[model samples]
Target: MSAMAAPREHDGADEHLMELPSMRNPDPPPPPLPAAPPRRGLNFHPAVYVGFWITLSSATILFNKWILSTCEFAFPIFLTTWHLVFATAATQLLARTTDLLDGRHRVKMTGRIYLRAIMPIGLFFSLSLICSNKAYIYLSVAFIQMLKATTPVAVLVASWALSLSTPSLRTLGNVALIVVGVIIASWGEIALDATGVIYQVLGICFEATRLVMVQRLLSANEYKMDPLVSLYYFAPVCALINGAFFLVLEAGQISWVNDVMGKVGLPMLTLNACVAFALNVSVVFLIGRTSSLVLTLCGVLKDILLVVLSILIWQTEVTLLQFIGYSIALAGLVWYKLGPEKVLEHLVLLKQAAMEGRALGVVAVGVVTVLLVGVVWYAFSGPEGGGV
Candidate 1:
């Protein structure tokens, strides 16, 4: 009986070991020299093979100016009306195409989760657009672009306050660089009244705040519905809410429309509509692709390109200081890109790891990203006298 029991125990042990094969190591292969780690290389997408990003970004700025100059009505109102229309239409069309191609569920909105998910995002999206458009009115496109560079700083502050994320000293240094870049970019215009500076700062703060809120909202909740489905529903809601606001509270100021919208022709309307649509889509894609810091910096890039184009096309005056600031900002961008202790790569890696379910790695990468950003902010922060 003892021998039989022993045999059964051995059989059971073999079955258990077979079931947990992962715990065992396989036979070793022939010994060989260790392979070297792969070298890091700078790679660009196919579309960016010929500096497509630079080209598209430059084009975006030119389009902004063209749309603004072409439209007769107040910039924000016209932007709001057409942007929503185009976004709604575009997303709906895209959704139909996606469904037909993929044979997925046909854009169902029956879930309560869908409504809960989209409301905050849709609202913030519209608010951010409105704030940015309004800021353009109060500030020079250059000044606004300069101040908008502080978006990274805003996001860091929000993260620290909310305990959502912690940023490193390097990141903080980059934020400082951004502020300096903005100030240097606008140094020529610094002679303007203090009120103008205040407005620019406020605009920057608002845009930054909006960005943080957007990131937070997007990250917190997950809806079962498709992204296009949500976008399709959210668009009309945003348009309706913003349209109502424009009508009720801002309607009194609508008298300016006739002066600006004098004989709105089809061609002009089509052009403005296209501009507004492109702006929204580009911004959305930019935010999706990179950090808000990157988005803001991209704005700086766009502004520089626009300045050059504006000078060439319109012969606009760009003072020497403005040129210096642009140079400094571009240099800072290069610095951030090359520095080993930068947050950009770490942040990208962390984001990828999070998406891939490597939680432990995410923690390490996120910490590194934050530290790099903080360092960047500190290095680029204001000078000893507190001036950018």
Candidate 2:
């Protein structure tokens, strides 16, 4: 009996050891099979966004010029009012129909905010548009573009005066370079109009002030808005303000039945309005997809292209002195925005690349040198009336 009991006890101990092994290592459930990353939908490249913005902006400018100058509508205030009214209606339609203007919902806008913040900005916006459009009647597109290079300088001064930015000597110097360039360009302008220049200058001041005010509005966390939403809020007020100005200034002069409906047909005017509104939509995409640096650079490119287009389309005369001055202003504008550190870094990279015999750096330097030489030679030897 004792031997039988001993054998059974040995068997029981073996069974317990097998059970323990099974309980301790249960295979970890096959390690959870690793989740797949979510698939992303089609994303546009930054260049696409940049190109869209440039095309729309150029179209808007050219279209407005055509309507105001070539088409002989000549009434800037009326045209401006029409644009704002169309913008107001379009934004309202978009808000009702699409998710595009949903950003406006995020803004904590109250009546007080609208009265205090938006109305003032809209007033300046109206003034800016009126004056800018008026200037187009007198100024050529190339000269207008060159003059606009000073906008950043005006904005900087406005910011300082409004106490939004502290005064900086370095910044002042950078912007001063832009002023010098614009002055030189102005000097070289063959069809310079003092009246047009005054209008443009006033427009720049109003625009600068509006931008500063916009900065202040956006500083608050509650008031965050993209370009479209800002337009949605501001457009109505601007339209009303522009309408008032139109009634006061252009009501008697512009017989809408004759001037608008007869000369510029409804289809043409509607198309023009659509292009203008599309430009604002493009701004939404541009600002959303790109950095501020990209926007600044693209703006510079757009302005340059506009100058070229003006020459091709309208035979606008751009002199060598004007080119030199505009180039200087653009350089100053870039320097001001990018700062010394970034500029130095780029210069260092170029130096290193040239030293290493890279094709890109060497080619860039060569191209720039060729351009400078060509410009100098043309200025010295070209005919008095001949221009780029």
Candidate 3:
């Protein structure tokens, strides 16, 4: 009887344990994730070509300044207007020509797409171009470059604020390093010239936001659109907008146009226009190919080129301090470029999507982009224009 009673008691205890929530089942094993494929190596050889591309861009700025200094133009506004007009014409021509050659000219989208997508991108890009140009009018090339070095940081912040991407500690570290570098680079210069520093900072902020928006829009939708298509879409709109602005804001100032154009030979003027167009296109193409950090590093290299050119051509004086700051800025850029930090993860995500067969169309579109960009760049470059 005692043995039977003990057995019943043990069975009751087992039933009670089974009834409890914790005793239902042990923790299940985690689901296995698909293994990510190894990244293909980007040919370093392309970067050498990219270096030449960057030098061309840096030269455009100097040329813009030289034109402004030599001509009786309306400063920032005139410089920007000519840039917009030329870029618009160039992009439209090239975009149409490329489409014609490829036999892939899709009819321009009609209806709300223009209002919703096309105009906004164009206007914002124009705003970015104008703001940066305006800032350069006030700031030194070195100052603008140094401040613009913080672009990746600004982009990171913008992405996080928009909930497009999550903030990471590594990004924070890069941002910190960039801020330190900028402060050091600008310490003496800003002390000597506060207004220039202010404009430069404004340029950095605007340009950074512009970078974020470009990547976000490209990643989210319109991945199938050619990179040049954005230029075609944006350029004419920018020209129209600025054209309207010039009409309203500077109607009586039309004489400045001829005055500015008269300063350089027709060839140099044409070269300037071509350079501006090519630089803008190259920037858009590169942003699609790599992260913003990579593009900004390219910009830093452009700045370095500008500094050397400024010394040689403009006969600008540089002290030991400025040289040291320039070196430190370049070092920071190199470190950031080499480090495993990404300012625009969306670009990488797009590539991953392409790899996984999720976004094959996007990759297909970019396949011809590098080649087309090369052609445009070569066509636009010559000895007529020293820089800009």
Report lDDT (CA) for all predictions: 0.44, 0.70, 0.49
The global Cα lDDT (0 to 1) of model 2 is: 0.70
Query: What's the candidate order when arranged by decreasing lDDT?
Result: 2, 3, 1
Tens digits of per-residue lDDT for model 3 on 1-388?
0001111111000110000000000001011111112224533454543554565566577767666544434455545666667766766576566532121144246557667766765565555555565555455555566566665566567667766566677657655666676666666453245665665556555544544444444443222233345555555776787666667766666553365455555577677777766654443323324433444445454565565555556444444455456556556554554454443464576668877777564654464355334323332352322221
Error of 1 at 283 (Å): 8.7
Q: Compose the digit string of candidate 1's lDDT tens values, residues 192-288.
A: 5465466445544544444343344333223222223334566677787668767765677655446445645446656655543443333222222
After superposing candidate 3, which stretches have Cα over 4 Å from the reference?
1-48, 70-72, 99-110, 190-192, 224-226, 254-258, 261-267, 280-299, 340-388
Q: Residue 386's C-alpha lDDT in candidate 1? A: 14
Q: Which of candidates 2 and 3 reaches a greater lDDT?
A: 2
Give Cα distance to truth, residue 277, candidate 3, Å: 1.8
> Model 2, 11-85: lDDT tens per residue?
000110000000100000010112112224525786786788677778878888888889888898888888888
Which candidate order results from sorting by TM-score in descending order? Answer: 2, 3, 1
Select the stronger candidate by lDDT from 1 and 3: 3
Model 1 quality (TM-score): 0.59
